[model samples]
Target: MRSDTCQHTAIIGAGIAGLACARALDAAGLPATLFDKARGAGGRMSSRRLPDAVLDLGAQFFSVRNATFRRAVEGWHKAGSIAPWPASLWSAQAGRWQRHEDDLERLCGTPSMSAVTRHLAKGLTVKAQTRIERLVGSAGQWQLVDEHGEHHGPFTRVVISAPSPQAHALVAPHDATLAEACEAVIQRPCWAAWALFDAPLPALPGVDDDWQAVRVNDPRLRFVVRNQLKPGRQDQGESLSLLANLEWSEVRLEDSPETIVEALLDAFQQALPDGSRLPEPSALGAHRWRYAQPDVFAGGEAVNLDYRLSASGLSLCGDGWRGPRVEDAWLSGHHLGEALAADAI
Candidate 1:
């Protein structure tokens, strides 16, 4: 629970977790200041506009499982901002590709994946395009230090929602105990390629008519997505997105985008059925996620919050602790928010 003396809060990382935490604080009559290095909110839950189509180059889609996230999804659905994605999932194993038929309640933002997070960010005090390099405490309140060495702060509490490695860097200078927790967490990288073709692709077996996205066991490419197939996506010439396998992406992290795009497109071609033919793409590009996902660990135990430092007004939460999905991020932030609310924050 948050103390009444705890007034304004500073939240780093404008992704789902930070938004959820800010909303919770605001609900309890506490103000919040959100900070991120990006030009906009929704870290990896972002979308880019191409000449012909909108591409969700980050999070392809999300699924609702636990009640907490399901409740939020219902609100987004009623707001007409989200819908179930009807695309199929394919996984490759031992050279045999099998379709995933679990009938999952997959969800995605209507116009773009960031739409959901953008909706949650309304009415909050957000400092976009500003990166808070570190946190400092003075007198009693907490202060934020930007990369430019400027100071901004005097907040009651601080919540960090960045990736574990980034989070560790921020807190290690202040609290070594908490730094160890953040350092113990590791992450994986991913490389994504977006391409626009001249025409629509033929519908494949075991998938819907709108589009096709598959997970393959290729050397470079992992998942291939037809952007237009999902609900609320742009309808035009084919806009396909390819996600490289994690190991491959890590190995090629330093490669140029043009080089990566060519490799991925070639991998996609090789993944197609024998003798399948398609025209060359009109445009092609790539993006790299250096810390894309948390590396799954063997031990089940991990730190969630360092309340021992809470007396000094600091807390840490992020998807890097549990998972690297939308729901995981939301729940972690949501739980902290509820805790603060219970304390009458």
Candidate 2:
């Protein structure tokens, strides 16, 4: 609202990385506009509001391995946005078992994963449901168009934070090498099922003995989480949320949502004793991620392409160039934001 004439940086995608970029740019005293095609913030770190409870459909949990991420997680914990949960294992080789409590901490967004993204996006300018159809360099500026062919800005710089395939489509015509790099980043699809149960079903054999987390070794079951057992769910008692792994969901991807839900419910019943007594779900849904995870990881390399557009100021950033995960996307965007800010200076 300051009407500052500083270089306008356009960032595509409102996921963790995009929000992080926006926050970083604002802190650096730079003007930026964050665009996302989704209706709201939180791309992969998404949550669904059910009739009974909130469900996390995107990232089940996030662990902090790096100092920077750890510091960020600590801040979130202080803000009541995140909490640590006990870790358990469900490997086919080891069977269902609880790992000894260790100093290591596994964290999850409070209530839902979206809580983390929403917290991070605070005070940021985000334009949702706005798609960037194409990028054209004109007179040293970059023009971004929406699906309707309406152009938004002749931005001083542009950063695309979409998936690799989409990013390749956007930049291939202009920068062949950058497009090639984007294409080189392969992604795998994942399907997931989220169910809300009414009752706290009895524990199953080879499942969580300590009531923490459960990993099912069945080929159909990748990871299973009981919401009530999570760090912040103790107060929410009786309302349990379950997240089924991608392997099972992928096998039933072609099935209708209702069919998939039924199959999952049946599987759940068969896996646990008196599982049939589990509460009838108040809500059931499934999501298909065409590019769920990066096939190969990029290490010590920036997952972004900065192009002068043969004379224009434009750049592209996204998970495809960066490594996978919410953190990777955020770091890449931050890197681009810093680069743009430095160039403006």
Candidate 3:
């Protein structure tokens, strides 16, 4: 696996795993192309723009428990890409368990989580709005075809960092072993969201504190966060945004987005005290994460390839393949990059 032999690598999906893999490959002096179906990067590390402010629609907040992830968060902090959200855990049973003012660690990207990916994508060759329908092995090289049958790439190796199901579809024909490994990875669908308000929201007993981050295990609510009171939002004036993890969202994921938004808004109102008069939100949005979190954690494994599959230039990497969290995605990508680089050398 020489550097010249590994001339090109094709990475699928421009989410955290894909971006992290691209950065790691570039750092190893390997040229790679990143492809994503979205118009822009940052899958799950997403945000929605309202009239005056932005709301984080996916991945409400993340904590760095791993050393590698901590260092990366530090770099993002210095670059002004991410900032600490001074948050305390409020649970129905625990009741505001711990509040850390000194080292409040949960971090979110400034402006929005998507900004972090935009910063990382700088100077990288990213192909957006490009969907890969299939991967074909032609003339001893891999070729990617879009839905319209447009072909791209005759590369030596391909790294799929998309969700497990999507990755399985792309690589199944070319590499059955890898595809079967992907089939073992299951992701849970989540109907989570962001709701923006015109006026300040009322403070619930244990729900709304300084920041209104609550963990409700009731059948109706899962988690809630006040976006305005989030870490970087201390200075931003009183614009209220709420994130809800609704059970119904998970149940009726295939339903229309408008229907989901309305249902979640109703649940939100019920959770509040003055429930009825809460001003109609300036904007309401719903996000359906088909693979929100991995149903089964892959432990600390790098690539769970089938023994029969050749590991020369193929790898599977993503949050589902490694651990569940965002940090796990980053670490998994970094691990896969190092493994590929080592094999290349």
lDDT for each residue of candidate 2 in 110-146, tens digit (9 for 90 to 100): 8678888889888888888998878887534788888
lDDT of 1 at 336: 71
Best by lDDT: 1
TM-score on alpha carbons, each prediction: 0.90, 0.83, 0.86
Expressed as tens digits, the lDDT of each residue in 168-231 for candidate 1 is: 7888787777688777777889999999888767544444464356787887988888788777
Alpha carbon lDDT of residue 57, candidate 3? 69
Candidate that scores best on TM-score: 1
Better of 1 and 2 by TM-score: 1
Q: Give the Å error, residue 208, model 3.
A: 6.2
What's the residue-level lDDT of 96 in candidate 2? 25
Candidate 2 residues lying further than 4 Å off, grouped into runs, are 1-5, 87-96, 100-103, 138-140, 205-210, 231-253, 266-282, 299-312
Error of 2 at 339 (Å): 2.7
The local lDDT score (0 to 100) that residue 345 gets in candidate 1 is 33
2 against 3, candidate with superior lDDT: 3
Cα-based lDDT at residue 77, candidate 1: 91
How large an RMSD does model 1 have? 2.8
